[model samples]
Target: MSQALARLPGLGPRSARRAVLYLMKKRENALRPLLSALQTVAEKLSTCSICGNVDTSDPCSICTDPRRDEKSLCVVEEVSDLWALDRSRLFPGRYHVLGGRLSALDGVRPEDLTIDQLVRRVSAGGIDEVVLAMNATLEGQTTAHYVAERLEGFPIRLSQLAHGLPVGGELDYLDEGTLAQALRARRPIA
Candidate 1:
């Protein structure tokens, strides 16, 4: 069990062992409920076909919400970034999760992401702005540029998360206040 838990993203062997022991000691109040929740999620969770968000419902609530700003779209490198932006409550726009960034060394390309689908979404009309909310990494910047080129001349404004964020900052790691300020001060790209 400890080894299994350690396979999860940030967990180490020692931490996982401690966590497993803790859960076992609190089985009734924690482990059972956690198991039930995990089972439920595994049974019901699905990726939103439109935005790549994980949700019980297709298209996800954000894509279906009538209150969202249909004329603006936030493009993210992954669903975690979408959740980070949502946590900030700074953007009312819909989202388009790109799955991952372009990485030449890793052989990831524009085709590996949802760039074509994003262009198609924008081309469908009503998108006045497209916010590039990728991480502040070289791959992220490269992917953003490729996307911007794909979206050029589409009439929609293109922008990115503003300065103040460190060079390698990621939206998922930023506080709500910082995220809000970045969104408020976003700059145009093309």
Candidate 2:
């Protein structure tokens, strides 16, 4: 159990051991409820057939929500990224999870991702804009470019998430790559 818990992201061996100890000490309060919840989630949760998101419903609530803009689609590399963007609530649009980014070193490819599904979605029409919300990494950019090329010739607009310094980042502490990107993406404050 400790090894299994430690295998999870951000949870090291020490933390996993501590968690196991706590759970054992509070078995009635913590372990039982946690087990029950895990069982329920395992039994009820499923992947969304439309956008590849995990939810209790087949299409996911976001995919089925009528209030969301069907004309705009935000493509993310992972379901976690999708959750992060949705948590912000800044984008009132639909989403497409690409499963993973293109990485030749890691053996990930366009075929491994949901690029085909994305193209099919765009081909179906009603989409006006497609936001490539990939991470600021080499693989992410490569994947974004590949998706853009695949989406070429479509009437839809293509855009990418801006890469730059964080809101409270110090200029002196920043890296040159980030500074360069910030300079390149600079906009006039009208």
Candidate 2 runs further than 4 Å off: none
lDDT of each: 0.91, 0.95
TM-score of each: 0.83, 0.95
Write one digit per residue (lDDT tens) for candidate 1, span 1-190: 9999999999999999999999999999999999999999999999999889999999799989999988999999999999998997789989999999999899998888899999999999988999999987789988988899899999988998765666788999988877886888787899
Strongest candidate by TM-score: 2
Residue 71: error of model 1 in Å? 1.5
Per-residue C-alpha lDDT of model 2 across residues 1-190, encoded as one tens digit per residue: 9999999999999999999999999999999999999999999999999999999999999999999998999999999999999998978999999999999899997899999999999999999999999998899999999999999999998999989888998899999999998999898999
